[model samples]
Target: MERNFMTTTKPFVIIGAGIAGVHAAESLRNEGYEGRIVLIDRDTQLPYDRPPLSKEYMLGESSESNIYLRSHESFNTLRIELKLGVEIVSIDAEKQIAITSDGTIIEWEKLLFTTGSRLRQLQVKGSDLEEVHYLKTLSDANNIRSKLDNVQQVVIVGAGFIGAELASSLKKLGKEVTILERMPLPLAHILGEEMGEYFLHLHQSKGVNVITGDSVVQFDGTSQVEKVLTENGRVISCQAVIVGIGVIPNTLLSDEKLDVDRGYVVNEFGETSLPNVYAAGDCAMWPYRGANIHIEHWDHAVNHGKCVAKNMINEKSAPYSAIPYFWSDQYDHRLQYFGHTKDWKSTVLRGNIEDQQFTYFYLNESDIVEAALLVNQPKNALAVRRLVKQQHPVHTDLLSNPDMSLKKVHLRANEDKVSY
Candidate 1:
């Protein structure tokens, strides 16, 4: 397909106003795109940060006004039209127009889908109880926080990032928290059994009850959530319940006209299969290391928005090559992970794992760093990111040494100063 090089008066319509959509709009203005930008979302509130919804916001440490990504005046200064609480019912790629639910049609020269993802709700018995909640939006956090006073014994389902983070926050609030996971070890698939066991023990040592190899079969309550029943015939009494199993990409606007797999399939330039259209954030799966992968982290969304916005403006497209990065704060431990890899040949550990401060390096056959996990080791984060991005071989002996710095580990190939 040929690029739309001609600048038109029509608006550049963006479907969702989350991190990706907001950044895309800002990047468009910064990239000298003076055309009309329409940012739309079904949410009534201004675009807000989501990571805090389960952590600081739920703990009441962060205020509602602090969670917003941009001020109202900033949007006006950028000349970006904010269409909050409006849902785009349908769109015609052929006609280059979109129809809203309230019988409104919007014309556009280019369209970007930053629709993000929706929470994966538990569909079992009593899942619709009043006290049961899923933390995804600022409003969800508000709803959960409003009832925290009455919620003494809280049951958290799933031991993923959100669930673990919520457990940490609730435990800090003096709530008796119980986390139920179907897998034998929490986060074993993503962080491996060793690191997963560390997390299991970390939560357990912090007074949070971590139950593995069990699943919630039903939520029993009269009006609100009173207790939870597990598949192993274990009934746990709780005043409230929070479910955070996962999320599914919101690709409803695709309407079967665009290519869809795990998400909207896009190339390196963030261009969808359809012409004059693009997708980013959690809803778009772009090429990564010869595979199309969708990352649901905040860092990826910010960089993806910036990369795609440049492509939308320039006739020459560039590949999105930003390294995938994300961080989680559970109690005092800040877990930072860099790079993306599902498989590794061997894992190397630096510092003492039992001390709760360490870094784990996932290496391929060539001794090149594929990913690294830093547990409470903030000093090693930047160096680890560089090693993963450089993809250079390193000395394992030096890497495991506590005295050796990671910035110099890649230089060990030479005898004098080490290779740069």
Candidate 2:
């Protein structure tokens, strides 16, 4: 399909108002695209950041107001129209128009689908009970917060970052927490089996009933969640059940012909197969770092938004080549992982695991693939990310030395870019 080269005076319609959509809108303005912008969201409130919802917000350390990425005044200042609480029922790509649930039809020259993703529902008996909840939106967070006082025992399904963080928060609040994961080790698929086992020890030591290699087959209750039944017939009674299985991409409104694999498939420039339509964020599946793979990290979403915005307004086309980086905060440890090490052959360990202060480096042959799972050592994470991005090979003995700073290792690379 040919790229839409003709710039129009008509408004650019963005389907969602989450992090990706908000950043895209801001980027468009920054690129001098003064054309009218219409941001449609099914949510009643303004766009907000989701990372805090499972962490500080759940702990009551941050308010909803602070969670918002942008203010309504800023949107007004930019002359961007905010249509909240209105659901787009259908999108006619042929007509270049969108029809909302309330009979509002929005005509557009170019459309950006940043609809984001929805929480995957728990598929088990008694999941319809009132006490079972899934965290995704701001409203879900508020609802979950309201029940915290009464929820003494909480059973969390899935052991991903959200589940892990939520378990920590609830445990801190004096609630008895239990996490159930179908995998043998929590986070095993993402952080490697060794690191996953380390996390298992961390949570178990914190007094959480960590159940692995079991799937919840039923939620035994009358009107509210009473007990969670595993496939092995084991029962876990709890006052509330929080499910964090994962999320599914929201691409129902896009052209059906568009190639969608897990998410809305797009080129490195964020252009879909359909003309005058683009995608970004958790909803987008685009090539990263010249590799034919899609990433769902927050940094990827924000950068994709910026790139899509630039391409939407400028004559010059830029390819998306941002490295994927993600972090998780559980208890006192701040785990930061950089790059994709799915195919790494060996992992080099630094510092003492027993002391709870260390970093792990994943290597593909002699090349540094990824690194820096910092417990208390975060400064090294920056250097490690740089080294991995630069593909600078280091001596295994030098990297293993606890006294050796990453700065010294980069300095040995004969690159003056590494400042003391």
Candidate 3:
């Protein structure tokens, strides 16, 4: 079905030209909203995919051209007025207008805030050093890439996706890497402790110094980052420091009182407390179906963007109820995870770990709750996602059988036999 919006004379202003904002603009056109569309971004260039920056772009496998999400011609064809390098300073909800950094005011009937996020800063001694870096923006990536030659012993402050990926990337360049994570295991909270332990092994096997249960208290150096002092009083020497702790949503422009949690709180429809103003992307904290809690994921961001745009133009739109999904590429392994399994009681691993192709399914009692696959077994992920969504009761015998495919198992059984 064509998801087009009604053509109105007044322009629909969208802030931030990230993936979410770009998708929202395209979704507006696809919904038949042929009216004036304004896409404002603080970046001097057009919106680009950030995932490639740490992986392909850093390795020189992909160029800058491959990172561009939309071309100028595409925006021109869609009649989108691109406002690059203009920062939205503040928003007046009552007036339905936004003032830019240059004091230019623009009125809008509906506003979509896709301002995304910025990298969390580290406030400590030697944080202002020349070699200390935080990767978030394209410029930051460029700077990091340039310094790769001089970086010998790299200290990563967090063991999150960015930190892990950077460790793998720098390892490929023959750099000694040490990852310091406060959690007991890397990705322990997101992928659960057991699976996180497996990942720890994977990183250590690849010669990465995985340091957990430690936090960087301070950096001791003269003009550059020379040593990192942890909370445990252990000092580690490093030529460069890359802090990948986390990110904070950029929501300072919104003057209206919206529910702000760790991020900007929004309902299932990506609607904040304010009327006519919506949010999406990393800046948004929208609800997840399975977890029934607001989550921050790339998939959630894109989905929320489309949902918010559609609801802004249409009155009879459905609420955002998509499952949260995300993936990470580290070394040669492809990690794909779907749904939330924070409360899962049991986890089953399918396929051989030695073969490097397996799917880990997390179950709560008898219900399949979540699944994560390593390597490129997308079919298994799809089948498990369906079972999780339907809350189907998976048989222990069938799940344990290496010969029995998840697709066949799911399709052959009836709901009565599959129910918990």
For residue 121, what is the lDDT in candidate 3? 83
Query: What are the per-model numbers of colliding residue pairs?
Result: 2, 0, 8
What range of 10 consecutive residues in model 1 has the weakest lDDT sum?
Answer: 1-10
- Indicate which candidate wins on lDDT: 1
Per-residue lDDT of 231-315 in model 3, one digit per residue for the tens? 9988999999899998888877766476777667777677777888888888887766533354556777788788888987884
> Could you give candidate 1's per-residue lDDT for residues 93-181 as a string of tens digits?
99898888876778898999999998887999999888999888888788888899887999999999999999999999999999999
TM-score to true structure, per model: 0.95, 0.93, 0.92
Off by over 4 Å in 3: 1-9, 290-292, 371-376, 412-414, 417-420
- RMSD of model 3 against the true structure: 4.7
At residue 135, give the lDDT of candidate 1.
86
Model 2, range 1-420, lDDT digits (tens) per residue?
Answer: 222322245589898998889999998998899889988899998899998999899999999899998899999998888889989888778878878776666788889999888778877788899889999888999999998888899999999989999998899889999999999999878778998999999999999999999999999888888899999889998999999998888877756767788788888788888888899888988775545565566777788888898887762387777777778889887878778756677777889899998888888786555544667678787787777777766777777888887778766754533532
Q: What local lDDT score does residue 234 receive in model 3, on the 0 to 100 scale?
A: 89
- Pairwise lDDT winner, candidates 2 and 3: 2
